[model samples]
Structures are given as C-alpha cells and as structure tokens.
Target: MPNTPERPRRISVEDQGPMLVEGPVEVTCADGSVAVSDRFVVAVCTCRRSRMYPWCDTSHRRRVKREENTEAEDGPAS
Candidate 1:
C-alpha cells in the first residue's frame, strides 16, 4: 500500500481574528507566488494586514486602551 498524506479535519475561528486550520497548507498568490506551511495548525489572516501574507501575526487584534491613548496623544487630529 502506498502512504498517503492526512487531510485537515479541524478548524477554529476567533470572534474578531484569524481562522485557524489544520496545516501542511499551500497558498498560491495572485502574482504567481506561493506560500507553504507545514505547521500543525495555521492562522489564516482575515484582516489582510498581516506582514506575513497568507498567515496571521496577530495584526487583526483590536487596539488596546494604551495604544488608543498613545495614538490620541500624537495623532494628526490633535
């Protein structure tokens, strides 16, 4: 019998964040590029702000109170 790769069977979703899926995933970009992940689990970015495209680096997180305060202090609206 030939060995076969196991398919992903689980997925986790966050309220306002990335979608976590079982990995060994391959992502193909519009520019003819490809991103591959062999992690047990992969975070797919939903906010489109990830520095690591096709993956989440917590860029979808809501701004915390401290961050809002700092931005208010130095923001262009000030």
Candidate 2:
C-alpha cells in the first residue's frame, strides 16, 4: 500500500485573545466531559471567562466605564 501524506495542523495566537486552531477538533475536560467543534477554525479560550468553557465568545473585549455628568451631580441645571 502507498503511504499517504498527513495533513498539517495550524495554530494562531493573537495578542490578549484566544488561540485559533484549525479544526474539526475535540476537547476533553477534566471532569470527563467532551466538547467537539466541527468548524474550519476554532478558538480556544485562554482568559477562562467564556460561558462556553473551552470556546471563545469574544468576552475578552475591554469594558468601557460611563462617566457621571457634573451638572447632574451638582443638582439639575438652573
């Protein structure tokens, strides 16, 4: 039988973001739970805040703080 070539795996890392790996991929959790993704590309969470666990939900974005208006703090405008 002729030997077949193996496909290469690719992985991408972004600054302050999840790692992207070529899929379809399977992930096994510490609790024996398994997660499978069939997308062409998959994002693995590194910040650990994703509701989907090992998946990236883009929740790593910076949060904006709302500033209070000085006029409102001084008691309504005259």
On a 0 to 100 scale, what is the lDDT of residue 26 in model 1? 77
* Worst ten in a row by lDDT for model 2: 1-10
Best by lDDT: 2
Name model 1 segments beyond 4 Å from true: 1-8, 67-78
User: What lDDT would each prediction earn against the true structure?
Assistant: 0.78, 0.85
How does candidate 1 fare on TM-score?
0.65
lDDT comparing candidate 2 with the true structure: 0.85
- Write candidate 2's Cα lDDT for 23-75 as tens digits: 88787877998888889999998898889889999888788999989987899
Tens digit of per-residue lDDT, candidate 1, span 26-48: 77777989888889889988788
| Candidate 2, residue 69: lDDT | 94
